[model samples]
Target: MVTYLLDIMEYADSDQVIEVLGGAVSTRVIRHPNRSFAFEVTLDLEKGSEHFSTKPPLHFHANQDEFIQATEGKIGLELEGTEYILLPGQDEYCIESWANHRSYPLELERQEGRTVVKFLLSGAKSPEVYELNTLFFENWYKYQEHVVRKGGKIDLIQALSTFDAGGTYVSFPRWVPFGRQVSQLIGIVVGRWLGGLLGYQPFYREWSTDWQLACDKMESSIFQRRWAVRSKPD
Candidate 1:
């Protein structure tokens, strides 16, 4: 792990391209503070292929709050258990902490070539696991795209692990009482404990920005920090 960390550190000096979903999505970070991080995401799916899902399953942030607004075109958003289409002029949707939400591409917006949306993230919880910032999104989106481009599946354990790394927990059916708690427990055990036993990690050098950056950020938790490879300072 230390050798791999050293190998990837050579590339960390340069900025990584923020594209994902087989190049269907691009992102840029505008603000990067832990409490008020901001960024723009552009989704440009292929013509007549809006069915392709470029988003993750509905999940809830245990410690983060998300806000989204369409700046250029329309985007499909499912928030607070209600699915809706958000136009450019629509009001910013504040996804409170623990709210169930997901975002995906839209067909109607493809006519304009691309849909640009801005997102604001604030650390809503104590951030004891991981903070919601550009680094978290970097590994999260890149890993998803890596799996898609490989035309293969990354086991459920790996997926859950990444969700945990980003402070996102799988949201169980809302109808079930105490579903959120159940989901979090499943993620920590299956994604963190079992996945770690199987040598799976929440962050990978192949899909993330820098080895040390992740190592530094994940120090908030022992489980999260252990998977990030590190070396002694020279």
Candidate 2:
């Protein structure tokens, strides 16, 4: 399959936005060509509100490095069990390959306003890394809806397992017996087959050319109200 990565240091004219965590926030793929660099932009819908109340599952890449730049508002990051708060204009935080990490907003108090961040993923496996996330966000809600129809909660394991074939492995708690091996097996055997049947494609075909149209659509969406309001200072 062909892949594309976005150019570093280039401004994105438009971006394909996808909602996550129930429309609380959205992520846009800024650039992804068929090379080593990839870029993404994230916007928080509710200023000052937590992007996600709970910590995300721990995961790491074996050959990709991530750099995060806070464009607006502050962000909190946890890298290798250490916490750091980053304010706008601060230096970018680097997460080297194989470093266990996660990030969220630092303050969840009042409507301090929204935050915007730019993330750059690069290195030997960057294209695959970007594709893995693209696949998940693109089909996450569909997977959830499917489970809801069956009177079952979202099957995160099954949904996330789709990335196993591409090397994006999820880290389970150490206490879960054979968790890693079992999950990998399920992702490879069950997730791959099921995802194919469900029509889940890993890469976005129009991201490079249709990004401007996507950006326009997202700006006019209901979520854009938050952006408008946040533009005015408190």
Candidate 3:
């Protein structure tokens, strides 16, 4: 299985991309096939280091509070620079528009790896996110290293523009005709690679299972359901 580092700079504002405090985090946003809604979550992997940084001045969702949890591994909540170790199975909350809060992995040597997911509820859909994501990744394959340095940062500014205005459903345009199909396949391919590299034997085998479940739950507009699970990060 291949694990792509969550290069949010590909689809988000680079300056807005917060480094997950303590673990390797991969974030993916899956949009609903028939609606203006989208579900985004980050899978936090256990790391050798104990420090991470948050993107300050987060104002993405002024109307909603984000629901977050450490589904797997160890993490310490960083609220305005103070650290609070969050036990496995514990849940946390944050208001993105209000508090400048973020999380990092705990510093303990014996702490197990962890996975954290965030449910963002927003009505504004950014059409440029789809455009830039498709274009950036497409160019990435052809130009590879050159694309990253040359024009990668442009994607985020465009995404922010599409999402700048407030609305009930963030309107991300479905520019690629086969977007749903492609995203599913990417999920499967990425999941498999990640599992193999991280030794999630059983977990790797179930990547498709989790992707399907996440897709199904997305249809119902419920991001918190147990069925909407992603792979467990080690």
Among these predictions, the greatest lDDT belongs to: 1
Q: Candidate 2 lDDT, tens digit per residue, 1-234?
A: 212233244455665666545554555655534324344545453531442555656665544565665656666778766787766556566677656677665544522644444334333335442233443444543454346457687555455543542345566665778755765666555554454345433222232233332233223423221222222222
Per-residue lDDT tens digits for candidate 3, residues 1-234, read 322112111243432222232334433444433223333434343342321333222222323343344444555555544566554344344434323345454443535322343333212223321212212212222232233336453233222322221211121224755543443334333322332243322111122223443334222322123333454444
Tens-place lDDT per residue, model 1, 12-52, is: 22434487665566775553323445555665556324425
> 2 or 3, which is superior by TM-score?
2
How far residue 115's Cα lies from its native spot in candidate 2, in Å, is 6.8
lDDT of each: 0.65, 0.48, 0.33
> TM-score for all predictions?
0.77, 0.57, 0.32
- Poorest lDDT segment (10 consecutive residues) of candidate 3: 162-171
Model 3 lDDT on a 0 to 1 scale: 0.33
Model 1 C-alpha RMSD vs. true structure (Å) is 8.7
Instruction: Give the C-alpha miss distance for residue 210 in model 1, angstroms.
Output: 4.1
Model 3, position 142, has a per-residue lDDT of 27
Worst 10 residues of 2 by lDDT: 225-234
Q: Residue 150, candidate 3: how far off, in angstroms?
A: 6.1
Better of 1 and 2 by TM-score: 1
Model 1, TM vs. native: 0.77
Q: Give each model's clash number.
A: 0, 10, 17
- lDDT value, candidate 1, whole model: 0.65
